[model samples]
Target chain A: MILQGADALIECLKQEGVEVVFGYPGGAVLTLYDALYNSQFPHVLTKHEQGAVHAADGYARVTGKVGVCIATSGPGATNLITGIATAYMDSVPLVAITGQVGVSLIGKDSFQEADICGITTPISKHNYLVKRAQDLPRVIKEAFYIARTGRPGPVVIDIAKDVFAATMDYEYPTEVSLRGYKPLFAGDEEVLRVCLEELRQAKKPLLFVGGGATISNMAPEIRKFVNATGIPVISSLMGLGVVPGDSSEHLGMVGMHGTYAANMATVECDLLLGVGVRFDDRVTGSVEHFAANAKILHFDIDPAEINKNVCATIKVVGDLAWSLPLFNKLVKDFAPDIKEQTASWREQTAIWKQDKPMTYKSREGVIMPQQVIAKLNELAEDAIVVTDVGQHQMWTAQFFNFRQARAFVTSGGLGTMGYGLPAAIGAQIGLPDKKVIVFCGDGGIMMNCQELATAADNGFPVKVIVMNNQVLGMVSQWQRLFYGERYSHTSLKGRTDYVKLAEAMGVTGFKAEHPGELEDILKKALATSGPVLVEVALPSDEDVMPMVPPGGCLDKMILGEC
Target chain B: MKYTLAVLVENRPGVLTHISGLISRRAFNIESIAAGHSEEVDTTRITIDVEVDDELELEQVVHQLSKLVDVIKIVNLTRVDHIERELALIKVKASKVNRSDLVDIVEIFRAKIVDVNRETMVVELTGEASKIDALCEVLVDFGIIEIVRTGKIALSRGPIAAKEM
Candidate 1:
């Protein structure tokens, strides 16, 4: 069909099975917004461009689809920068469409002009500047394909204003054929055989899963492998939901603030089978001491990450979705009695789990952040939980019990604040039938609190639980331990009523200042038909426990309050 | 130790900035770099020379460069027997009396005098990096006015294509 670039973009989106877009319109994108008005595709107008991009990111994480977002040029494009980087770091599939000035005005510094393609080069999987209306269809096709392909990441397609108005005969490309871009899916048979032999012979073998496993949709395969071998599983923060929380063989999250048993198991294991995980600094406290006694078996789709941080004794570079099942098959065929081989190791790990459990002191009259997360977990077991970075994020990772794949979504690599509320909006929009909750800290909530209006306006029914500690909890903890406890600028001293703020944004609001009132307030907030916010006041000085200090080994963790 | 890496990347604008930005952001110094279109249809090959403390730093540089989306492949030329060359243009101060001597020096190095004037003479030399440095050292005595040198470009001495690997 012959159509203008803006109409063609909408056509391409429909062809790619995109049902909704999160965006904010501006002068540069006025024509596209006009096209959207007459089209059936729903575009949710977000309060901020950053919130739109983050909502897209959240949608992609939950639905496993390439989430789409649109914005104007210059500031609008720049506002999406943080969210784009967040998506890039976490390997989420997102396609950001930005409106640019006309081609003649691009480099001339015209009004509202910026070099977005250049700015996003390092952060995006790939980017394009559309100079012709004819190229829009092909670019859109390639953008979606690249965003959703191997090692999924964000891609940017900046369309010029004139191109949006120009006419073109559009035909969406059926397939993408880039000569230099091919992702490997199958693992080498020889490498799998070697890994199987190591698993069969090792006295103590542990399965370490990461976000890569979850991204590749290999949770079922991982669970099958773990069950067949009876190997204990430890997860990175992003890998939390790959193994059900109820599984006896699964250890809690392992990292800087990981559980005691998880960290100990990492140190004592003889063989570490890492799947779909880059050894981030948080996970491997000190590289020299991380898995020192283990022969590492690393499996990932990105070859650049194989030996980037930690070296693998036997590296298998392939998609986890394919390589994991192959490993399962090889184990079933070769090492049928793998459970007996690692029986003693499991017994030792059980002792570690029992000796040092995750514990926090219960103050008589004060509410605890851990208790709030625990209560939410109990009441909303099936809700998709999202969190912003900080003390509450770590607390959620520690206290909440995630039961299904893609049930927990948070900014892992970038650790960006203001991520929870918008991401919760995205999750709620993606899975409307499922409950969606955002566990945010006071510091993070204040960063993008404007998103509350976006949720209430759309009636998405997202529940926000704000752990309102009066200080920057994580940074305060670091200062108390490392610095002279000067507490420079970490204490947030102000009186901003969170419940009143929520009500002002047209959302129902509740507050709980005492431990006894939290449960009732939380239940009331969750039962609301529309968006709601529950602000629970927490102690100002509580620190996340089992923290591995900077440059310290996992074994040198601080177990309690310093 | 100094290492040379040949990085093949998609031919696109701002790709060079992406590569250089990554190196600079990591605080790694690039001694010299040269880039041009490769034999591939839409690929450009860039040769970068870096001086690092050890092999570990070199490995990290290679790994980080490979992380860029435009970067298709990268190979360290130090691991194989390779041929490297650099081109340089030196403009030297010249007088009537010293003109013959300057010509003699150029002849000895098999260098060509690309331009000449009453006050200055420009000599162009193309050879291995060491040869270019040697020529520069000899011409310095004649009060060299200015010099421009292309960074080192190298290829392995074999039939195998690095991109195919």
Candidate 2:
């Protein structure tokens, strides 16, 4: 019944169903490492605390479960800040545990002692500093709950050294009671009625979906509403795959890199039905100019999100699962002729789609990124594709035809650079049966390339596809587009041999220089088992087209042909 | 303007450090902050009045606060229609010279004398933050020695609750 503090912590983690944790042990958390020596639970030791946290975040995002990370206090804990903030921005569930100084030495600022709890407070969903060993079990239980429930986010638990050494009879609590925290799931009916009335009266209605809708798995209902009412669906960067991009009613992604038709539709529509989206700046542009003509009807589970950015003419604070059904029933009852209005909208959208066709050219003797993406789609149709932030991310978005919810998880809001590999590892760990492929740029991959070791050690069969261009391709592309081609801080010099690096990390390495070699290398990476890295050298000049330059309108996008 | 913010966080260690660290890291000036748990859940309500340019900075602070691990929710109750309350125990000189004026001022503010000695009068008062400030300013003339004020705590007016609304 009684155990060492470190053993108790590990036991608590095992009870919470934590199969894998990403972390690096140091002086402050040495006891935990000692306990883990004889422990059964697996931990992926990352090169950096940042990588550890990110790997956990990736795991959380893909699995819809709480991702766990651990680090010693001081610099080790501080390094996790960026990763934790990244999770917080995108609403990923993560639980980060840090070792702290003894309770007696807490205020004295002893060696390796940092106020990690205070440092992580604003960035975490909730945090705890356990001074007494008796509090560890309850805090750990609460941390998991707080991290995973009601708009999931990262929760940090910083344990004092004394607590880790102290002995206590540990038992996990079944229920937690937090007076200050109680998030509402269902929306009010009166608000829903008002929203329905507005939808019924409107001629042109736009269904703007966000990541929240995808997370909630309300895409089926969203499709029903769009089909029944004939409203065109436009999604945010994070909202991709909520409404299938291939669907006739889908407007593709809206915002900076959005389709011309999607942006135009957002403006021309009379009623804007925003569902499960935060209306981020990249999507809205200037808040005053955004959806200027529309009377907005916002439906979200978070009440605070309503009127937070753009004001909603009729706000329905509830889950889309409930709201969409009611709206569908009301529209069917009130406007039987809604089909006629939708038909015209769909026809107009068709014309707009035809006008701006996404195209790319394959320079002879070189592997193009678009061609690689299209090839992966053909070969691995059902495989999960994850991408880091860069030109490759945009190219993947434009090329990949996603069919499932939670399939396209990227650091959209934060636009974190070193996101892909760890995210793919997380995705693979979360869905072990499913094939997880990470599409990362050379620059992005090298940022957190050390995670390759994490994947290799865990035996997680994650395929890392590196689109090597020998530069910070996205920023360079932006400079080419907007800054007169004077590339600054975008060039990545002395590119490391990715294959050798992969091999060193104890993973299978496959390299492709030509288009002909890509498919074989990709297949090799998929078949090799455990973790594999496939490096494909892309043409340096190739740019992610159909990009709306920053601070520019959607109409001003630079299409490849145009 | 320097504003006092009363935030309620979980009653766990590192919460205050988290709050103060966030303020310093964001380069925001914190005039004063005081925190402790309420009578309800193991929640530590912190009252921090920060001096910033406009409401935008405050809103940014609130957003940043919401992002924190331990911070559950934030309400700028100042803009909302609500009842604000603060408890301050002040030890003031109750000399014969300014005793009558102090008593008159205390009567108007509906304050109670909690402690009394030959040289000191510990006055306890509960009211809106600004009212307390005005009373404190008035009592400053009587040579106030020690002041312990429990920061602002608020409750929404009418049936429009934070959850239901």
Best candidate according to DockQ: 1
Please report the candidate that would top TM-score against the real structure: 1
lDDT per prediction?
Answer: 0.90, 0.80
Estimated TM-score for each candidate: 0.96, 0.84
Candidate 1, after superposition: displacement of residue B18 in Å? 3.3
Per-prediction DockQ comes to 0.45, 0.24
Q: TM-scores for chain A, candidates in order?
A: 0.99, 0.94
Give per-residue CA lDDT, model 1, range A86-145, as digits (tens): 999999999999999988888999999999988887788888889899988888988898
Per-prediction CA RMSD (Å): 1.9, 5.2
- Which sections of candidate 1 miss by over 4 Å? A333-336, B26-29, B50-69, B72-81, B156-165
lDDT of model 2 at position A424? 83
- B107 Cα displacement, candidate 2 (Å): 15
